[model samples]
Target: MNYKTTKILWKTFVWIVLIIGTIITLVPLFWMLSTALKSNAEVMQFDMVWWPEDPKWSNFVEAFTTLPFGEWTMNTIFITVFTIIGTLLSCTVVAYGFARFNVRGNKTLFIILLSTMMLPSTVTMIPQFVIFRELDWINTFYPLIVPSFFGNATFIFLLRQFFMTIPTELEDAAKMDGLGTMGILGRIILPMTLPALTTVAIFQFNGAWNDFMGPLIYLSDPDDFTLALGINFFKGENNQVQWNYLMSASVISMLPSLLIFFFGQKYFIQGINLSSGIKG
Candidate 1:
């Protein structure tokens, strides 16, 4: 084949693959939305229904108003916001130290930190529960929010990678201008690392927003339940599962994450690339 013809064929193949992948990914989401607008009768049928004959737009209103979804949503937002703040603050400071400061055993410590990521959370779950129980943190936001203030190994690693990419000359100039460590980090380092920080925040936000296990374990009060937990209860409240309402609630719960990801996609991709090895 001619070179130009071969290149065109390759591009066509890639586009075909991407289109197929997109359809596969979107199918489940489309199904979920389709089911949300369906009736129980339609949902139970052996024959698959791609779309409902009469779409129940009211399912969203009913699902949202039937439970304390508003309260749960607020609770989720509070936890997610706090979690992002704690993660950013703690991870930034820790990453800055590892990236900028020359300290004895810094490399060793960083390796040790990275190693902790390999340790499964299942291994520490019991110990963490016991500690939190001892502190009387159960059924409290403390259990959910407090841990994020301690640096997450994955986020620290990403931030540290991005931090190392920055030129040291900026720090040198800041020092000459009498900017302290915090000042340099705030004014010079953070502005440049916006992509990475946004990536971290988005990760934390999605994790916190969708978190089920943590809230399930730590929060006992119904009023304090997050969306995930609340959805579980929503299913349990009915003897026969109302698939329509369940899917509707789920669709509602996922909207914030969907919106955030769609809006921040550019920054998120950029952050991942820069942290992977690209210099700032």
Candidate 2:
């Protein structure tokens, strides 16, 4: 085959693979939406249906009525907000320090910090639980929110990487204008750091938003449950599950992350740009 024909064939194969992958990813989401709108009888039908004959918008309403979904929603929003705020405040400062204000042992300390990421959380879960128990904070939102205020390794690394891309001339310029570290960060650097900050906020928010294991471990009361655990309340005795309401709750759970990514697409793309460049 000629060179042009080979190129066309390769492009056709790539397009076909991408189309298949899209269909595979979309099928589950499509089925979930269909199931959320399905009546009990329709869901139990032997053959799968792509869409429901009767779309039950009221499944969402039924989900709310059956569970403390409203309460869970409020609780989740509260936790997610705090988680985002704490992560942004702590990570931004720590990252700025690492990137712009290096000190003695700073390099070693950062290496140790990055090394922590290689260890699985399961290794420390029990010890962490014990420490929290000693502090009398085991069954509270403290377990979820407090550690976040100290900054996450991944967020700090990501922010630091982005911060390094900024020109030091701006820092010197700001200093000449009599602005200190905080002044420069607040007035000049922080504004440009929006994309990185947004990326961190999105990750932390999504992590806290979808948190199930932590809440299950630390929350004793049903009232204190995050939405992930709260939604699981739909399961009852004999291991019977409420299909429609469960699917409805799952669908609802996806909205915040969806809305965030939708509106923040521009900033999200910007965040990726720093690391996305490839050198020849």
Candidate 3:
């Protein structure tokens, strides 16, 4: 084939692949929405209706009303917000220290931090649970949010990688202007690393929002349950499940993450850039 024709054919092939991938990804979501909107009888029908035959939009409302969904959502939101804030603050400060400072044994300490990442949480879960119980933090939101303030090794490394790309000249200039380290970090580094920060926040938000095991293991009070736990409440004795309500709840649970990714996509792209470039 001629060069122009070959290129045209390749582009067409790429578009076809993308179109098929999009349909594959969206089909399940479409089915979930259709099932959520269908009446109980329609949902059980042997004949599939890709679109609901008799839409029962009230299922969304019923999903909320049939359980403590409102309370669970509020609890989840509260935990997610606090966890994101804590992770960002702690991760950024630690990353800044690692990227900018030359403290004694800093490398060794950082290696140790990285090592902790390799240690499976399951190995430490019992110990962690015992410690939290001793502190009376179990069954409280403290177990979920407070530890994030200490720092996460992976996020710290990500931010530090990004931070290392920043030009030292900017900081040197800031110092010449009589700005302290804190001032330079606060004004220059923090502002410039907004993309990495946003990325970290998004990750932390998703982690905190979808956490099921942590909440299940730590919290005993139904009042403190999160959406993930609340969804489990829909299951009953004899292995019976409310598939429709569960699917509806699942869709609702995913909305916040979807909304966040949609709005914060620019920052997410920026983070990918930082990850590929020099730390600043």
Candidate 4:
């Protein structure tokens, strides 16, 4: 084949692969939405339906009625918002200090922080639970929100990398204008690192929103349950599963994260690229 024709054929193959991959990724999401709109009979049928024959919009209403969805949603949102704020505040400050300071043992401290990420959470889970219980944090949101304010190793590492990419010239100029370390960070460095910060916020938000284990461990009251725990309970009742209602609740739970992503798609892409040191 001619070289031009060969190049075109290669591009076409790549495009085809990408399209297939996209479809594969999206199919499950579409299935979930479709199942949410189905009746119990439709959901249990031998053959699968891509779209519900008789769309049951009332599935959402029934799901909400069947569970303490309002309370769970409020609890989940509160925990998620606080955790995101804590993570952003703690991680960014620590990362900025690591990036800017040259004090003794700084490198070692940062190394130790990064090393903690390699240790599995299971190793610390029991000890952390004991500590929280001793401190009367169990059965409350404190255990979930408080520890995060101290900072996360992964988040610190991501922010630190992004902070390292910034020019020292800005900080120097800020100092020339009488800005102290904190002042420089606030006015000069942070504004310039919005993309990286937004990236960290997104990760923290998603983690808090979808957290199942932490809430399962720390929270006990049905009244205080988060959506993750509440949703799981929807299937565990009297050993019977309600597939249609379960799927409907799951779709409702996903809406906030989905909307956040769609609206912040541009900033999200920028943040990920910047954190990875990829320039477009």
Candidate 1 structure lDDT = 0.94
Looking at model 3, residue 28 earns an lDDT score of: 95
Regions more than 4 Å wrong, model 1: 237-239
For candidate 4, give the lDDT.
Answer: 0.90
**By lDDT: ranked, best first:** 1, 3, 4, 2
Q: Could you tell me how far off, in angstroms, the CA of residue 123 lies in candidate 1 after the best superposition?
A: 0.9
**lDDT for each residue of candidate 1 in 68-92, tens digit (9 for 90 to 100):** 9999999999999999999999999
Local accuracy of candidate 4 as per-residue lDDT tens digits, 56-142:
999999999888899999999999999988998999899998988999999999999989999999999999999999999989999
lDDT of each: 0.94, 0.89, 0.90, 0.90
Model 3 whole-model lDDT (C-alpha atoms) = 0.90
Colliding residue pairs in candidate 4: none
Candidate that beats the other on TM-score, 2 or 3, i.e. the better one: 2
The 10-residue segment of model 2 with minimum total lDDT is 271-280
Cα error, candidate 2, residue 16 (Å): 1.3
Candidate 3 regions with alpha-carbon error over 4 angstroms: 278-280
Best by TM-score: 1
Say which candidate scores most in lDDT. 1
Between prediction 2 and prediction 4, the one with superior TM-score is 4
- Alpha-carbon runs more than 4 Å astray in model 4: 236-238
Q: Estimate each model's TM-score.
A: 0.97, 0.95, 0.94, 0.96
What's the best-to-worst order under TM-score? Answer: 1, 4, 2, 3
